[model samples]
Target: MNPLGPGDPLRLGPYRLVAVLGDGGMGRVYLGRDGTGRAAAVKVLRRELAYDQNMAQRFVREAQVAQAVTSMGVARVLGAWYEGSWPWMATEFLAGPTLDQHIEEYGPFDDLGVRELGAALARALQDIHAAGLVHRDLKPSNIVMTSSGPRIIDFGIARPEHGLTLTLTGQIPVTPGYGAPEQVLGHRVGPPADVFSLGAVLVYAASGERAYDGGHVATVQYEVVHGEPNLSEVPEPIRVLVAPCLAKDPAHRPIPAQIAAACATSSGTKPSAKKIWQLGELAADIKQREAAAKQLISVPDVRTPSAPSRRRLITALAAGGGTVLAAGGGGLAWWLLSKDGGQGEARKPSEEESTAPPKPWDAKRLTASQYEDGTTPPSLWGPQEGPSPVVVQPLPVRDLVLVHDGGSTTLGAYNVIDGKRKWGTDVGSYARYVAPSDELVVTVGPVTVGRTGRLLALDSATGEKKWTAPADAVHVIAADAESVYFTARRDWRQSDVSLLGAFDMASRTTRWTVPMPVECTLVTPPEAATDSGRLVLCGQNGKVVALDTHTGKQVWTLPRQAVAILPIAPAVSKGIVYLGGKSLTARKLQSGEEIWSLPAKSEFKKTYGGWGAPVLDGDALYALDGEEISRRDRRDGKADWTRSLGDVLQQLDPPVVQGKTVWANVHSLDSGGIAVLHKDTGKPAWTYARDGSGGWGMAASGNRVFLVHGGKLTAMPVF
Candidate 1:
């Protein structure tokens, strides 16, 4: 039975409980107030849990650590004591929803929002790390979006540097999905692990998708250790940031300072001292709205006509008074003259002042052709133009590209550079996946439940479908300039039979189909083309088999822990294939020999897959994590420079990179307006409101930004 109810009070030391806020796995959180009615959140441990000596000691230690930390982003512990059979701790009551609740209610946050959250949390972590503490449970549920800023809660799972283990038998200290690989394996974890968990939390907050997902706990754990994170919906610019945080090895993960700096650089927005003030104002506004709603409901209506009886009496009195007034006018005039000696003088207006005309609420509209033509001469590759499409809205600037999940059966494409209609073609029953190549577009469609697949090759410049094939029997893993390679499953009924195959693009012929072990799932296809004459396959059980692309012959097989195989296209400049899953491993295409394995930082806990497939621009490999995007040395994965984009924002679209400018579109929770940011340095370039219609999606190309609201589309110039 619950002991607390609305308006019920229970005294505990210096505070009196007003009501129960919530109950979690560990204890009950209460809304409490002191004698003077100052409110606080009181956490009371469960009787069974409190009875354990080790757990009780840990609880006290957490309280002490929390009290010692002075960061406003962390909840400050105010009091602690044991009452009756329960141990309790008190902290200042924060009036806001949990990060999880906020995301669920409002969807994912935008780029600006993500940046704000990332920076604030980074600062919070800095304090924690400085104090030699690791907040192992740094999930969204433990973070409160308080009026002042994000306040991290739940120190119960926090681990200090010196005193780490504080657990009872049969009590597993774990936060599934958010836990790092080390934590899942029951290995001793440190601050780096917390950073990894933080990345996972940010990914969830930003994309509303779990980085590692499976039907069961064991499967999820397996995927966390070996599978690539499903980041299909995550924005591209931010995707790079989330990658390193999900690195399997903790040592390779980035520190808090690096994370903070990276985020600042990514969003070009730095955390300011006024964040707390803004947070407070936000909280106040929420409270005000709630109060107004209550007041409106409680007010009574008063609308009734007055009685007619008084009307007749007043009319007769008025008739008699009129005659009297005519006679008494001379007397009344003398009385008025006595009452007032003179009238007041009026003031003159200033010379410069004049009545101004009201401003007109006019909006500019650009047609598809006008938008496209605007990008023609000077900006050759700008977005496309057409009757504004109902799908993903295109942005100004040629580099911005749109990858859309077409309705029902078709996958659509619009060039962001000039708002030009690139292509809209039907692939299958449902086009679930779409990926871009320099010269080709790869689209995957699920035709049926467990028995269908279709892979369509489309001309990049035009919307013409180059070829369509039955992909259900074969996994169309990846493609390149030369050919497409796929892994085929034979007796899927046995759960283990599969084969690997390759198709020559020019000849339009199947080159080879090599048999493989049973129950094998194809990782990402090899990055190199079939013309490179090599194929790589990683099985569900962790066997990596290399094959000759032209002939069905095995080249070599390497054993690894069953993990997701992230296929990298053979580097065009460097000629190395980068495969990353639980760990980042670079292998030679011809020899299949190991090149190098850079250990992930110890703090990273979850894998949202490779952030951006080891983007190789030159000698540098660009990577993304929860906190920031980093450029690392391609040869040894050495850090060069890092930039941070704050926490994940709700309703955020993936970022698009143009020449030197990276653009991200974000929508606010309070007002559904669109905010565009320069991706390189997370700075706001422009913010436009859509009033009540609400923005659905946006894309950039050339000079125009195409916005979609319901069925209506509007185009705005990038400059």
Candidate 2:
């Protein structure tokens, strides 16, 4: 069964074995050729490991998750399948070497190379963590050096902790020296644990030594638990950063994103004057020395001094010098003449050239006047007509505010920063949902007539009534600068059906309504109207429908399964819609086509199902499920970073990012408190606790954050 021996069949599956790359605790890895003759390193599970059901399941799951993560720095998972009794996973076979092998053959890396390696590994960890899986086993042996950069391999043991436990009584099996204390104790393990391992790996890679210098496993574990790491060789700037990553308590450890940012800041090389001067001088010296050496080596004869010979040499030298001088003068003249023959010539600027004045600052500062009018309007009011609320709610605007208090309806102009009372009218009691638009706020409630709901339009500023209508089922409301759309559902004796309808804001007319094939929930509005003049809608049943806003015609429909859907409103940035649930997907608004999708962490499969829509900012989409918030690329759904906020209080508010900080209203499960985070690094900025009480439903603006509790609002500064 060994593929490395001579005369044995080198090919397995689509790859041909070339040589034994190495052997590890799991099995032997073979260098092999693919169907196209490209090289790959395939790790085949040992028979002992493969036969163990638990280990095999973990291996297969790791392979599945590893394949879902897409990053050039991480070794690409090419294929995984059973070949006899062994299961194997193949990755791009790099020709360089393992970090371990490199260190063994060449000692430790230089400071610059070590920092570069740290940054690359940190980035790779970011990608892996973003996919919701932890590289539980990160060491020098798992990192492969390549021409491009480091490639992280061996996800055979990586696993999500969603439904899994760290240890059963004392069955801890992780590498003793690299494992965090919580991991050692077999308690809960999260991304922080992986960060601890990464810190140990970096230390080993930089110093060519283990974090602990003990001889016994117990001694190493003791050192890891109680002793400071031997980081004498690590650069000063990185020492402080890596220290936190090795914290014994997972809660005290820095997240992978923070580690990466720190590594980036420390490792960014800048050219210096001394280095530049040295390089220039070295180049000049090398050129002069080479010329002198070449002349000496090329000459074949040497002559002793003689009067007649010297005179003849002098005469010959004088004639040669005159010829050389004339040629140089003529070439210079010709170059000068050629400059004037160009199509156009630029004139020198005058000494008194006027410089443009500095451009005016465009960013608006937060003014006290914005929040000074602390007057609270009554819950019920008639329309009075004024300017609508400004349309800025992060980006990829999703969600409209509509309130059905009892049956008496109140329509509010909703935005990320402010929500204003637009209008209030007596509809009925027992309202369920409210959907908002620039000009109208629709209030819906369940009724006997197939879950009937009511829709109303009001003057955005004055709260004056515009028009009203009855709807079947109301789940969401989407709007542009000019019009509004809503999704409604109707239930028959045995089946439930859904519909999407659009209404003109100026005319107060039902523009159109189209029936849906199945009962579905609306994710968000399209980023732009399609060529067919219709808005796009994603349903809960995984169908994307484009319906004409002016007519009841179906423009196009496609099948898609998303855990979450967030519509991008026109008032915000356009051309992109955010989706997250089980998996994250971004779609182009114009064509109802998927742009990209990223795998969501298994832990988020449940909590994120009920979390708010993903928030979009520029090209980044932010989504939080439970204690983790991930920033992903809006174009290709690639993860930029993932940060764990830790489990806090119940009924926690969503996270808001401002400047370099992320503010959130958290309630501690043990007690009531609030936790704040640095957005760029995911490190805890601060934590504030309310006396004897818990808070919920928080909102933030500028440097201040607000929390509503028992009919009272508490505002606190973030800094």
Candidate 3:
């Protein structure tokens, strides 16, 4: 929870506002209390949004829709006042994590647990439908797993069964992947649409994967409208019950009553709601949040009979890690805010802040056409003499960009704000092989006659040695918060197979070591990626292997996953690893199960060329295929838009994403420049044309793109 800032109202009707539970584009949710000390989650329309007729209507409609439904399976609305200075609505505060959070933190539920969850949600839908309303959005995030059971929340889009789908201009009618086929097409929807969402939710609960997914929003929506649901990982018993709810035709889908009956426990009876939520890791987490919420609201009686001071409230919030028990109906802001807030310090706002939203910054001063027409925006700072012409990718660490020219054994740091040199170090190591670990930079020192390769670290700011480990590392792969992963060889010249190992950052020791899979022969140095406790080794021989980072146990392996000649750089995110080759594919990081794959060859037999490594930003995957730079859906690898670059060298280098531009290096016979495309529409934004190119690289940080070409480094503005 955040402390109230300047211009924030102290009270709303009879409820005295305390800390801010959450805030979003539309409004803010606050923790409030009445004279009797009854806690509530009060939602108020944003001042700017209140002035918007459409937004104001939507806010009032949410209150009306949420209030119409009365059931034990839904959060209860306490009161609402739309015609007032600050339009607000209050609902009973819930103290448990949403179903989405539970599934993410604790893993997918067991079969029985999924059954209970589905049954409860189905019954909730029955009540909502009975009230002649349809819960348009019923994804996992909207359902709170309270101690009692799963309670449906969020009615911001709920409407009468007869109402047509309507949203703000440019807004998708429903969630991309979870919405039913009818909803995805913007067709009229009814209770069956909610059932389809329930089925999607159950699929997520039963298996930690989405029912329909893609790299981009359009791809997911396309799948929802035209493709089959992915229920391959779901257990047979659960699949049978949930499949009917996801029928493409609404009339063919099961009703809420039927779904509840089919999803009941094996004993042919409804499971105990309380018992389900009071067991396992999920229960423990929910209990902690509930306890924290109670402590946050526990105010003492004083002689002055006044509300608690801001300092005292902040103290209480700090002790509870700022966990807010918010009304599920209006808690989207809280959910987004608390996403990363659980692990570290709570964010305390300043005593005053402007009520207006932050202003958007310009992406770039010059457009792609403008640059081609001989116009240039002054460089943020650079064209400074760099350390070397043959440089690897520049690593940005805090206020500096670290450069390691492959030709030199020295590493150089330049201030990002200005192109001034900060420091330089000579560490008897291959300058190109380096990875950043917080304040220290990890690198591989050259092997000596008496010893194998050694791991070394240097202070990023001062160029001072921090620590060294005789771990026999040959190349740095990647680094996470805890450890730095690398490939090593006992005898660098003798071994064709590299050993994978990790260096513990905190203890400054080698954590574990294991041989690379025999099939993964490193003809060339391999590329690696790490995420979700798995380190993926992508070899040049088309063999990919995932190993448990902690134990070095092989989790899964894929043979001939990509072409053998070029090293494949795997991109990992959200527990999925993406590989680009004959077919750009997404697979579960831990299990190596394919989520979606897009073939390189089109139906017309036209070759788009094999995709280069892909760079993912939010929902889009950008990669160069032959002469064309395409933005494809990460979920399904379907190209949303593509721009053809007449003739360019197709290196393994993935596109770089900064601000609103997708930057790609196009090395043509003449003087190739970086192609700047609008991230969303793939429109040509601008080109950073250069005069000459032997080899060049680009890295972006702090709204600036660092370019290295012609033996000089320059910083360019970005959208």
Candidate 4:
């Protein structure tokens, strides 16, 4: 379980939630206390599920069965609140390691251990079946090992075997690799299905991985229905007992009672419950962590006589009333002041900020190599493997082109002039966004499952570790010489609110955190709109706001628009912020007034890479619409020259404009290359052809163009 983050609820229903136990797509599990001082685990369902009538009904019915089970091997459900706006259930809290975590950490169980575990599970399932319900979703994670024995939990998909099914064929929810063929085929499931699941579970306990490949759902279903089960590593006696339980036909599978008897008969002396702790230290670690986190939180005294009044206060607090439970007291305690309280009137955008000198396009200058054909600077690195390749737009600092290799999990500085790696550091073993500045290189990777990602800073020249701090969940929106900006949520697609913050490296804290007025639930962080040292934030449904980075204050904001404005990075040049989204927009940096805006000419492909940010050059603003790049007068948005690369370069990097020449990187493998266009006419001045191996986005300094293609960094001269 992760420590409770800011804004996580402290109380729900009649229970005072103390610590987060786990979180899943369905909801959150929190350790809590009831009004009687009894401890329990409370599960709060996702709000979106409230709108699904069918799902809500199933949830309530399942909760009843969960609370009704009397088996010692099952965690008892205590209470549930289904009719309220937030649906939650309280169950007897179990402190132990999940079977999944245990097996993952300690490897597979021995043959004797497997038989013992199988016997315990068989008896548990038999009891559940006697209750007339089928635990349709039984996986390793659902089984908790206590000092006494294995206990089943999470009856989310459980239902009476004879009851009319709420889910239809192919729609029934079951964890793949554990579900029976009948469940996968969406046929009516019964106790025999549990037997099949048990067989699969035992197979996993004896061997580390699952019986059927779980890479693809459809493939897994097909295999579960027809393919032979994988038991190559299973030892003899337990293997003999498991083979018959996984029979293709449910009727052929042994009953739980018979299976248990057979396993026990052949099994040696049963292992003691005290030895269960030997599964690994995972459970112990969780308890230790939970104890530490609880030290900072004020848990509500649910057993107090005034509990009803306190709960009402908490309900009100959720609506912004600001009540807080006092530590060590059973009575109502502190009231947190509202953020709006005492804050003076909101600041208005001033004309000075709007009329400030339009900033020039600020980017690294790459000296295009003049070395002819031999100048295809040698690649600093070689090929690596992984489905996710680096999103190349080489960041050049001095003579080094900073690049990341996701396949190799390395971040390095390559000499732009020599193409030799100067220095490299292991960033991590996952996809990360690398942002470069004059002094530091910052990289943010995906959230580490239960924990947030770290913002790692490396010295620009040495590639040596500078500092490490917590970062927004996935990606960096923008980075400057002082701080890194990012969106807070782990997955943009799963969040309603994204926290936008600036982390100050020196202070090791957030300079400021403001909730973006948009829903950007994509995997990566939404790009920030910036110009002239000010940040113009884009939100879905037409919300755009500008902030002054120096004082961490809002400058101006725009009203809602008809379209979502979750932009790529907004470009600022000549005092105007050019925003990209479903449409292109130009707004005054100071006053948040729209200079001009245009809807996309056509839909772009669904890929994560370059945002369609407008490119600013001299008096013109260049923006992408479909496959075309159009230029307009920056002053009045008057039309200028427009060009199309036919059907090529759909994933475009922002074009770099210098004097009368323009350079843009093309993303392609077979035909991808650089195209140079005349600034005056929307026609190509010349083109540099590559075997589609050149990276997207070329860095220009003086007359040199630096590009990273196919994991190699190179520099070439702009003729």
Flag the better candidate by TM-score, 3 or 4.
3
lDDT, candidate 2, residue 385? Answer: 28
Span of 10 residues, lowest total lDDT, candidate 4 = 324-333
The models' CA-based lDDT, in order, is 0.52, 0.49, 0.72, 0.60
lDDT of 2 by residue, 588-651 (tens): 4334455576664545332234333465543455666555676665556566777765664322
Superposed model 3: Cα runs more than 4 Å off: 1-14, 17-378, 428-437, 492-497, 518-524, 602-609, 669-671, 691-693
Question: What is the Cα-based lDDT of residue 275 in candidate 1?
Answer: 44
- TM-score per prediction, in order, is 0.39, 0.36, 0.57, 0.41
Best-fitting candidate, measured by TM-score?
3
TM-score, cand. 4 vs. native: 0.41
lDDT of 4 by residue, 501-588 (tens): 7776557777777766455643434556443446666554445667755445676765543243334556764346776655667765
Candidate numbers, best lDDT first, in rank order: 3, 4, 1, 2
Consecutive 10-residue window with the lowest summed lDDT within model 2: 325-334
Total clashing residue pairs per candidate?
98, 20, 11, 22
Give the C-alpha lDDT of model 1: 0.52
How does candidate 2 score on lDDT?
Answer: 0.49
lDDT of 3 by residue, 483-560 (tens): 788777757565654677888776778888888663334224577787655788777666788886666779788876
Global CA lDDT of candidate 3, please?
Answer: 0.72
Runs in model 1 lying further than 4 Å from the true structure: 1-9, 164-172, 266-719
